[model samples]
Target: MNLRQLIDASEGVVKADRVITGGTLVNVCTGEVYPADVAITGDRIAATGDVTAYIGEHTEIVDATGKHLVPGLIDGHLHLECSKLSPTMFADAVVRYGTTSVISGLDQILVVAGVDGVREALREAEQSPMKIFWGAPFKTPYTLPETTVGFNFGPAEHEETQDWADCYGVWETVAEFVLNRDPDVLRALELAHRNRLPVFGCAPMASSTTINALSAAGIRLDHESYTAEEALEKLRAGMYLLIRESSVAHFLNENVKTVTKFGAQSRRVGFCTDDMHVADILREGHLDKLVRMAIQAGVKPIEAIQMATVNCAEMYRIDHLVGSITPGRYADVLIIDSPESFQVERVFSRGVLAAENGRTVTAPAAPERSAALSPAFQVPELAASAIGIAAAGDSAEVLVVEMDRTVPFVRTRLDLTLPVKGGVVRADVAQDALYCTVSERYGKTGATATAMINGFGLRSGAIASSAAPDDNNIVCVGANREDMALAVNHLAAAGGGQIVVENGEIKEFLPLPVAGIVADIVPEEMAAAEDRLEAAARALGCELPSAFGYLIFLEITAIPDYAVTDLGVISYHTQSVVDTVLTSR
Candidate 1:
């Protein structure tokens, strides 16, 4: 079938604007290789065949010699926020890597999606060749208390505070104002559906009913399961599963039985990198590593590919445009020497050459410079007296942090009594681990309350990370209270970034101006910065996870034990929030 002749013969079947030839097609339909040509029209696959009879004078032709044509690789689940890049830059980078589509991770909710940010991202994504979809943010900085909580504050109270939105007003409004009054959840769902994008979210294990309700409301998938049992329940109840890299890795280390038990299910399952760090991506790989991990867990290679590609496209309703290289599917494909190895020979996106010999052909725009550092990270000037603790005796019993090895929820009241420094109960680091604090960076500046934590092998010094999306507050973790104070003071001096401080001196620092959390730098630069930071941590005698492991603790969604946000110390297991000032003492 020549390009013009194929178009003319199947006028109703296709309206191609361009044609591509000279590539082998990855027939995902049968998991085989074959030769074919493909034509595309206005972001959709028109027709595909030999296309020798369809050649036309006006049709733009791409000679994809020595390349493979298949459907664009689909990232089943990923958070653009993790890249810390804007939508355009993220799309540009991933497009060059042969990813034509991605399901935007739940980060939209935490950053700005509720304020029409999602629509804006979608609009910008359409300007590029790659496709973008988003999952709505469903978790709350506060819990859903009742169906009808009154917004009792009068106009006078509103005028008295600017901290309203960042701390409590916005959340209250979403509950009592937006979600409670307007049923805006349904409206948001409808808006996404109208725009033809996939909508998925976080559903905790305890909230099965809400999951059912979300499914009823048109949410098609979830990515927050901690166990195979939880995943199986959702699958049986009609929700597709997106196994995140962290969650899967955690569970596998705990016990691989569940995965070995249910690893082969063809439907209702897919892979997601979720919140992968740049260092991990560079050292490992993206979805390539995810697929490999699944296959190692006993999943079949073809089934893993289907989960990564076809199953994901089906959930997002883009299967017609991608997920296979059939007669009418786009020739976005990958050719490799071995399916199990995932070694790339050549790659195609929309039937056009994108990458060859394991390197990107396109250069995405450089990321924009970050905003100047904020003074909010500076520690308050205080005498040693300010770090005071009060208890009935020399030792005080407290709720020690008990983190679920897999899920984000932490168990509280695992009691530990430690030496009281100056009257303040403190972490017993020599026993193994201690606690840290992460003040929410989206609001007014405030110190996060300190709590007991374990797992990071820190003997001394402080480690700080931030989720300071818009606000400038720095989140800090330390075994030594004096080091915590000194690190914050130093950050005040150096601007914003991850810093490791020991005995009142800065050992290593990675300045991240983007949201006071991410760096403006690329993966390689960020990776180098992380290496330095890790060395600093090891110099202080800490080694278990990377120095960036504290980064995971700053995120409220994944950490289950007591966590410090701008709101104070919140017990995710108990749904109780205590004032930081009161809790630390």
Candidate 2:
């Protein structure tokens, strides 16, 4: 917007293009509510008050009587690719729920297509009604050489990305690097510090001392706190705490106690869904859902709104652009029924009416598929023998990665004996010990590693995913080798996707042909396909809450205990490869 026009509109010398009158404004900046009229000139909020003199012949007047005007909600941190939808589709899914802005590192796509892919995604984001701010991805593979990725983001990449117009901060500095003071990470952190950018952190279950170390490393924000104590420790260490509520991990209820019990201030706390499925976003609301849950958990209504809006913007250092219904800011406002219910009646993004009554007014056109985001699968054809674990004797004692049923992301190492037949270690279905494998798909090496995992509860089928976290390898788990091989091969043939196979037949498949991570479909179509995949998995005797959820995280090396990569089963605690079979006798 032109500075002179904005000034004239605010001074009433020129008429505002639009005016929202007769609403009780929820002032998130001051925690106060009062009657106000918002005047918009171009895409910025020109003024807020009576605004009687700003009315003219062409002025568009929006009557917000009996409504509460609020700043559009912002998600402090998230991975847009995890929604399994394109940027336009994801924006359509969340804009109706009052979320007008999101911050992401584009780390998933970066892993597959490198820096060029990130640039493609940013160009696509421009077509959406919602604002997308990017962070320079700090770590691409996210760990040691055990994890494979197409790109290795480091100081050079950071320097290039930090100069982008939309780049806000450095994204997700993992705890292992910060704690160990890795030289490459330190150099990246130094560049971020020199550029006056904040560094996002990933330190799950960190102690107070570790938190102190992280704070001293210039890390200013974290979203992995699963408990109220962890949240409070980050707060006391001068770090912003982003309470996460994702599809696989629900830590909001437990972490919100920092405010309800310990009386920690809400300014340093915000809301983020680190990763969410498209179906979940459709079923449950987006940031609007977080606001309601926080209010229901004994937080003040206004404070919950603050956490969803201003707190998040302040945490990312973008408060000057968004997070409040103040002058000199973008005119992104929400008309809600009331503060207690927080039901969004209408959404205005940059002074344009974007959505109303839980639906976007106009759906954004999907961007043309970019070549950079095309299918990334490069694995060789596989056979049942390729996925089998060979044994030298009749029986073998193996180290199994046990999935914790309560916490889907947490895995525990287990040692158990299993019978061998046909010189192959058979999965003991009765004990729920299933076979798991991670196959290299980047074509750097035709490698596949097999391991045993318990508590998946798959009785007679196999599930495979090419969207494995950190490294987008093809990870498969199954009751038998035949089904596992079928599932893996089917996924690669389809380019990239998640699939379930039963009795050597393909039961369900959800294609994610974009860099093996995102689907170029509408939100409704993506959600329905996910629902069908979940049902197919359930029909195959899978007992997890979300079968694909478990499939995607199988190769995530950042988590604790044990994880499967293309190299083998890795012990996160030891940072070394663990033998899948302990003894054969």
Candidate 3:
């Protein structure tokens, strides 16, 4: 921990505490690979490439004769709540895959628990080996008139983050607000610029004019570019691009082409798992999976590794503390089989062995549960009558939100006619259309809106979740009113979580007690619980790969086409509420 000792150790005047010998060093800083040795003193890398003079009898030697030493991967942008695991458990899951650090937005937690909740989650992350940095989420409710939230994050909250040590920058500056030059958003941007913090961007499918406005407003990085051309435009416009590969979204293959076709030197790009599931992390790996996918897409192995390491660190201006194996860094390194296979054999965090051979060796203790994070669902008791759609006549033509079978988040508005029984319209299962609802649960408003959706593929059952992104409101979809009421009430009674109900019985449930978004459990248990929920959905004739995963996107207003919120169905194209029922006859 002493600066003088580190300098002396680097100069060979003091013996290193640990020395890794006989390994090929993958220098990300210089993009070169060669045989070298790494010497570590305390939690800092003392020297690299032949530490013969620094090694002493007391030094612990690690054998890596055929392995390559590379910098531990860093995820530039992520939403930890999307994993459904607590911060400590999420770290435990990804650390084995060589992801030693991550930068996340507190938007999910901020909506439910406010600023205090954000601080509480950050404190919990400190106990883990994975270094977690946060960006101050300036937009909470996302948009007015479409959704509701517990807290409204603005310029005042941005100013408060200036004093928080781990606060990195403004998170996900929305493109629409910048293009419109919204006064509050501009004030927040000004505050971030005055503090010298980089503004993270979210401008998917943006036009040249919008990109220009965003750049002129000081937004520096973006992760929503879906195509190679989009990525090139953002890079040419002087914005750092984060190639993303999430559980539901797969944009890595298309975006990595920017590096493969246009060369890697001029483009500032990195990797991010914007919103990944724990099951995906356990089965396919984390950022390491992204690195491999990039290689498969024709990107050079070293360039792909650079995107996962130094590029992310430099984007956040944390290169001095991490992102490389050089001296003066945090000694976070990975021992991989080779660049082609990209197999991680060992992981070192802060000069200590944290994981080996796809397992954690030094799992940190779980942080104590915070009382403030306890779920506080305040919605009124619901009945089947409360969720039914009343019809003006025997039959009615309604506007339905159709989920794209391939991409669940991509929706389309469809007009269809349905029969009415007892003056109430019911879900037409034969047509593959089901009723969907979003209920406000933050105690501010007890509002709930119902709409019809297609492509869920459920023949008989209902699914609901309180972990819906952006607004964090309760979203449910079902074929019948009874099962829908059962699922919604079950989540309310259990504080908050996800549930699948069939025939008025709870088939499967996973409790997310932490602000109704994350569960305080280990990765294995969380994955198992999610697996059971998916299986339950399948048993009821649901068709999606992950029905619960698809259910959570119903309330997300950022996506295109249509989104169902507590207020009503929002038409993204029109930017206003649309009639769910088109005509009655």
Candidate 4:
């Protein structure tokens, strides 16, 4: 602050840069509302009171009469890459929804592209409207030896996170801990702590024993609670619950019962959209929609706003700089007509008008990003013979994954008999079984594995993607190997992307050439392609949740029950490669 200028403004000798007058300020810090005026000088708030005495000819004024002025909404946790839109496009989509800050999990791109990937993500963040922070990934076991991904962390990239990121804090999952636990995970946690970063835990469906172990290990919070029982357990274990309302994980309804269970201690709860797609965010909303859901579930509006703002900012350790409308902080304020209607008329960021009437006033200009940051794909070639299934007998018993249409994460393990011809086993679509294959993209290993899959509901046609979770590789499932090969090759030719093929022809496709994780396109373009893909998927009789995203996790090693990788099918209970032929091994 300029002492002379501050004194002059106090004495009505100089004018404040901007002012929002005649508003009921929702003071998140004090849980109070008062009719006041907010004065902004440059990027920081200069005063919060009746500042008419400091009005001058050059001062800009915003009329907030009868509006509730609250601090900018902060999204506690998210993966911006999940939107499949570049950082610039993602920011444009959410700023109008009132999210001024975001904490992004770096696992997706980090696993796909490594240190350069992390750097590119940070580079994109600098151009975004929201204040974006990183959550450094602890991929641990998958970062080495058997079934490793493309991304490898070195000393140089590790140094970059020191100043701007937090720990992902997960040791993969409870399954990995029980079977593949390592010392490096603990070392990573300690490093994060030494830097004063909070180690956020990933304890989905963990037993009470595991939760206690994690708490003792210095993990401070969890967003993996899927039920009220789970939520209460984590909260009682001194873990703050994120109450996720993601595109895939719908835990907010079940977790919100904790407000009744803990009453005032509900302050320990906040909201997050761990991974949401563009269409969902565009149609339903973002953190603002999550807050509205909380209120509908019986949480008071002020407390809900508190969870979205102050409590979350405190968790990020940036409360002094944001999370509330106070002096010496960025002027991020929302003008709301009412909490019941949840209508936002205006949004201000850094004392500048950002959004009004459901649109951004100043959308980020689309730029040709630097080549170093905008990565390209380089997956190797594979012949149609590469994705074949071999059998020794006329009929073979094979271990297949059973999927449930409603719950995307949970899968059932099953052993089934399949027909064999010419010492080869093929997908039996009549039995609702489709042949699935996963291949190593980065290594171009040409190593591929195929298995019979159920509950994915694909009767015909094939889908291929390079965004296979955990260790992003090429994964495709189809009634015929020929179509599967076509889908895979289509994605390869596009550099990196998702593809749909039917009856020897291409159906729908969406390219994601940057890091094999995100598409450098606007949300509308991406969402439109997704719409066509879903239509084609439905026409082919596939019944997965969202055709665009759910199938990509077919190989996610971090989740439970059963998953597949280019290496082989992995049983989460054992965390080891399961025998494809049930009787052989």
Candidate 5:
């Protein structure tokens, strides 16, 4: 049936603006692969049949010779901010990979910092070819008991959120901080529904009471599951589980026996690359890698695909648009060479050749830099004097916290007695350890906490980074006190960048002029620079936490706890924010 004849026959019933000729359709709805011609009128698919029978002049035709058509791919959950690329660039990069849609969870960190920045991201998102569905960020961000560092929760202005609520009606109810079962947070969830945003909760609350409230309040998705038990409990409680790549990787590596038990229940779960850097994305692939890993770890391919596709679509209530290659769904499909290998031969997004043989066909233009997104770098009063040691005699015994490799928390504390040099406790590099300090970078106060951590491998140097998005005063820490001082100065010298100091001099640096936190450079360049930072840290004898820089955001009260921010070290276990430097040492 030619599309025109079909449209003409259904003229009083259904109409199509365009038609595609001779395409193999993978009907996800029926699990059938058959020959059919597809007709599109505007963005929606109008009809599918043997279109040659009803050809007509008004229809725009695309010859899908020997091509297979499927629905566009959806990224269930992601944080576009960590990509370092603005939303436009991000859309451009992923569209080629067949990602037509993304559920931007917790993305408001980039938007909530400022109204102007939020507007810019939204403007770019609106203009982009790929669909960008945003989740409204709840839970006041970067708000500690005493500090309002980085981007404080700018007032929830209606401009960025109103469209999603009033128009599309998708919203997110995020719970910040250690899940202390705050009823107010539940109230915020109710408010999200009131405002018309479908609520999605951030996982790992300390109390099940909060989880129950969120579930009862109708917040139905979670992405942070540190253990399998937590993942299962949430699923039973009716919250959609968006399992993160790293967390899954960690759990699978531990030889945990329960993954197989949960693998059968994978339908309730979806995949996400929550916080994947661009370099890693280029080298390792995106959610595809997570899918591949799951398959390799004994998950059935059908189940794995469901986690990446149908499950995701159902969770976000976008099943009608994509997730399956049903007759009516948009033709967004990947032509994989082999079902077993999952080697993508070509990709079609929105019925167009977005990627072929392994690269993007169209790239999105970079977003214009907003002055509000960039922070003003403040030269903190950090000198050699600021890096201090507490001791009564010529020798000092210090407690150095040992960080675990697989997790985001410290494992044990190391007690070491070392000689005091020039009235300061000196780091013993021969022992492959050193002193570290976390400074309050918000310019609220000159408060700094000096502590010790092992496994940086540096004998006489320091490395420092920060997540303070506003004042640009980096919360830096180092092994060598003098080198620590030099590192911050080096960062300031470069107008706000990450730096490694060795023996009182700058050893390695990546100039992050954007917000004094994210890189202004391209993803590959930033990845190379990050690699250099890791190499430099390892060369300095650090081996504890390889992704150490990520630690800066953990301490903020709004995110899950056991983290160090510019405010102070917080023990979510005790529900108390503690000093970086302990007096007992």
Candidate 6:
């Protein structure tokens, strides 16, 4: 690992352990592509030039003669926990697709088990082939009040910055800034700043005034812009832009257009998949998909690779070890047959043959520690009659959350008159409205709020998920209250997971033992289970785009206008629970 030895190897003074001769090396650092020989010693690239003398006895030569050698891909931000698989299984799914590293928003761990849970997950992430970096989550219940399911952690749970940045090799606190000049957020920013950590951003639909304030608060990069104009404005405001393409949002193509419009201003623009599901990754791809999307948007292949590799490493200040194929850098290389298509044929992570022929050659690392049970996963007992909604009289009026198909994140509150029977409100199938409920999962309050939601078009049946974002409460949408209770009860009894029930029978189920959020299964199995659940929802006459993903967001309060929580339905503007009944109507 000495510089003198590497220099000697470059001059044929020493033998290299491995020599990859005659490959078109992609020099992302200089934006150059040329034919060269790369010499590797151990896990570091010893030299990258004509290395005719470096070949000797015991030198392993990788025949890359006509193939393209590029740095392994890097994802700017992700949530492996949400992939519904353990860290080991998640790696097997993405490494074959050529992803070498990622920055994970560990907020999922915080939400399920607080900071202690985060520490445990970080320990397990070390066994993964894909280098996982940590990001300090700013949206815990302490920061965002609606994140409460009565699971509160004091400042003691906040692991010191050194524990994350040094021991766990974390990058920084991601996607946060003061909301309405909140003092707690300001205090959190000061803490991060004191530790010399860079803060990433998440500011969607922010006006000039808010953007300026965010910039001044040191949130330097954003991946939330949905349009080219919005991305350009963020860059103009001295913030880096991450063109995102996730399971729910696809902004890579539009942001590439923004990069083209910038001409020279494209340096600050990059790529990321802030949130993606395992089914989508198994079907489409990982970071590789975003790269292909960029190429389709008229972006040069090398430029897109830069955004996926170097740009992200530079943003996190980890370029010294990764993001390039140069001396002193980890030999994380991808062998592709062509530059035009960027088809990754073979992969190497840290000089290990991690994947070959679209499959991982390296087996998953052994489980370092047993899975710690998160108390948040505990659920209270409930009956089929517990979720019932009592009505004042016949033909009562109520406000329903209307779901919009074809386009996501749009809904209109409709005043609906429903017939009452047995002193309870009933669902109206003719109007495509169903009863949706969010029940407390931590067992603090056996509270359940039932209301009508339009959009699922469920003819008859119920679907329940404990994968609710932020709080991980049980959210169920169904055409019948009895079936809704059955689905929710099933999910609770299984610890925590997703379930689809129809005609008093269970159709699809996937158990998630990790805080009732992540499953102890491989990506293939997880994807298959999710696919079956989607098909089951469709079979039950529920017509909505990807019912699995669409309904999970029902309890997400981070999104727009209206969202349901265990406490009640929340209005983002008022930051309080909105009434379910239309008294005036």
Q: How does candidate 5 score on lDDT? A: 0.58
- Name the top lDDT candidate: 2
User: What digit string (tens of lDDT, one per residue) describes model 1 on residues 15-39?
Assistant: 4556777766666567666677776
Winner by lDDT between candidate 5 and candidate 2: 2
The candidate maximizing TM-score is 2
* Arranged by lDDT, best first: 2, 3, 6, 4, 5, 1
Candidate 3 residue-wise lDDT, 416-496, digit = tens:
888777777778888887989888898788987898998888898898999998888889999878998888888877888
Between candidates 5 and 6, the one scoring higher on TM-score is 6
- For residues 1-585, write the lDDT of model 2, one tens digit per residue: 677877787787888899999999999999999999999988888889788888888999999999999999999888888788778889998999999999999898898888898898888887777888899877678865447777788888887888888889999998888777788789889999999999999998898888999999989999999689989999999999999999989999999999999999998899999888889988988999999999999999999999999999999999998999998889999999999988998999988999999999996787777778895578888888877577889999988899988976888888889988888888999888888999888888878889998977889989999888888889999998899998888888888888989998988888888888778788889999999999998987887889888778878767787888888888888877877888999
TM-score, candidate number 3: 0.96
On lDDT, the stronger of 4 and 5 is 4
What is each predicted model's overall lDDT from 0 to 1? 0.54, 0.88, 0.85, 0.74, 0.58, 0.74
Q: Where in model 4 is the C-alpha error above 4 Å?
A: 1-15, 140-146, 154-160, 163-181, 261-264, 372-376
lDDT tens readout by residue for model 5, 12-98? 244455566666665545545677777664444556666544356676777666666555656776666555455665665566555
lDDT, residue 487, model 1: 67
Colliding residue pairs in candidate 2: none
- Candidate 2 TM-score versus the reference: 0.98
Q: How do all models score by TM-score?
A: 0.76, 0.98, 0.96, 0.92, 0.81, 0.92
Residue 45 of candidate 6: its Cα lDDT? 79
